[model samples]
Target: MGTGTDTPHGARAHARAQHGTRTATMPVVPATDWPDPPCAAGHLVWAETVAGGGYTHRPVARGTEIRLTDLQGDACAHLLLHSQARPWERLNVADTVKVQWNAYLRTGRLLLSDQGRVLATLVADTTDGRHDTLCGTSTLVRNTRRYGDGAAHSATPAGRELLTLAALKNGLDARDLPPSLSFFQGVEVRSGDHGDGDGDGTLHFTGSAGPGGSVTLRAEQDLTVLIANVPHPLDPRPAYTSTPLEVLAWRAAPTRPGDPLWDATPEGHRAFLNTAELLAAKDPS
Candidate 1:
């Protein structure tokens, strides 16, 4: 009897020929058109691209392992988050800045924030110190004419404008809405001190209603109201008005089981969960 490691060369060769020559079959699973599982917290999900460039849903919490098989390919996704009635403050673009230096001590890198916070640390890279801020994907625009009535529009109105508008429609009086509305353009209202911290001001949005309805909006910090008078042209119906702030608040406000919209299909609720799970697994701390 010969020990496995002490077998004769010819015997070893024979064994290798018999065992190594055999090929194994890999199981093939067909792709399904179902949404991915949801994240653990139920706040995030994942989406995979389906036929026709559309996305199929998945939850991030499913613990799926995703790999970028094609090293040369790029992954593009949009991210939106809110925290305490404001945009999430953690994610910042300036954290990836690279600084360059001379050969002896080539590059220097530093992450920056608009308010001078460090969002990330550049551990290593081929490029020299100091990355291009203009070229980076993380960019924040505080005030741009593009967001104005003419050139651009946000799917959801927020920030100072929304705050001011909410105040006005809630009957805070133009005088009370002034401070918050002054910086914005195309807003009109009275000016006075209502003694409501920074003086309440009104913010307004003017535009012809689209297929949905009218387009006038007013808001204050805690309240927001939208007024649209454009009836469906064909129906010749009376102008309709809506206070989206109330709806948004209801959707975002604290409640049992949270807002259903957070889990709704069209909102890509599952995809967000997947993203969160992926991020957690990556442990990009």
Candidate 2:
């Protein structure tokens, strides 16, 4: 394990060197140049903030690269992606972890669907590669137990409300909302007698993002995205204050032969090939 100061565990450059795949936080897009947004180059697609429990929904197409910036340090964006073509083909959290053989996600990891298709790739993460997919969105009961009066309509809304509202906008009743990816959140899994009585061990969510630190993902397929900047359930913070986060989407160029995500892993390569073939069959040009 590299020292926290010099190299973090699974640092992007290290991931690339060891795995023959690129992994490093992508550069931050200058907010100065695109202050008015939608950029002078016409790339910015969508931007919004959900205060703690607020929610927003977006639909973006393939080859669209979106950058997620942490305007403040304590932001935790609970994200879910569904297929624009087939909403049923949403982000399958379990498949992503099991197939990739990783519990934590960072730049260079591919988000996989339950149907064995590539949904998106984590291109850059400035938050020390600490995103979580297991802990999932925070809940009312858990929040109420941990911090009194946790409700969507309450002064401090719950994280689950974000997913519920976003799912509703997607035209589904959301009887089964899948687990979500918690960006800008870090969770360390430990095995021992946690004393919680569940015998499931314990998860300690640590670390926080710095202002302007960001993550980026290049869409491998057209995606129906739902977002909310809610705190992680394991967040040790006293209040439900959510840091403001930003999203910037630009028209992504075509993927080249040497794309990092395409070569990140054996499974990643296979998934990319499958994606390319599918997209090509859909449009030969």
Best by lDDT: 2
TM-score per candidate, chains pooled? 0.19, 0.79
lDDT (Cα, tens digit) per residue for candidate 2, span 1-285: 663436666475565565532222221334234445643465666655445456667789887777777777777888888888888888988989998998888778888888787888887787887678788888878878877866767766677876787788888646647888888878867666667653465677765756777888878899888887778888777877676777777777645569765686888787778778877898899
The TM-score leader among the candidates is: 2
State residue 34's C-alpha deviation in candidate 2, in Å. 4.8
Tens digits of per-residue lDDT, candidate 1, 1-285, equal 564546797677667767533222111122221123222333221222211101111111111222101011111111111111222222233222221111111111222222232222222222121111221111113222222221112332223333333334444432332111100011123236646443454322221222222111111011122211111111111222111110001111111124342243332243334434544565667
Off by over 4 Å in 2: 1-40, 191-201, 254-256
The runs of at least 3 residues in candidate 1 whose Cα sits more than 4 Å from the true structure, single-residue gaps closed, are: 1-44, 48-85, 88-91, 98-133, 136-285
**Candidate 2 minimal-lDDT segment of 10 residues:** 20-29
TM accuracy, model 1: 0.19
lDDT of 2 at 44: 64
Q: List the global CA lDDT of all models.
A: 0.23, 0.74
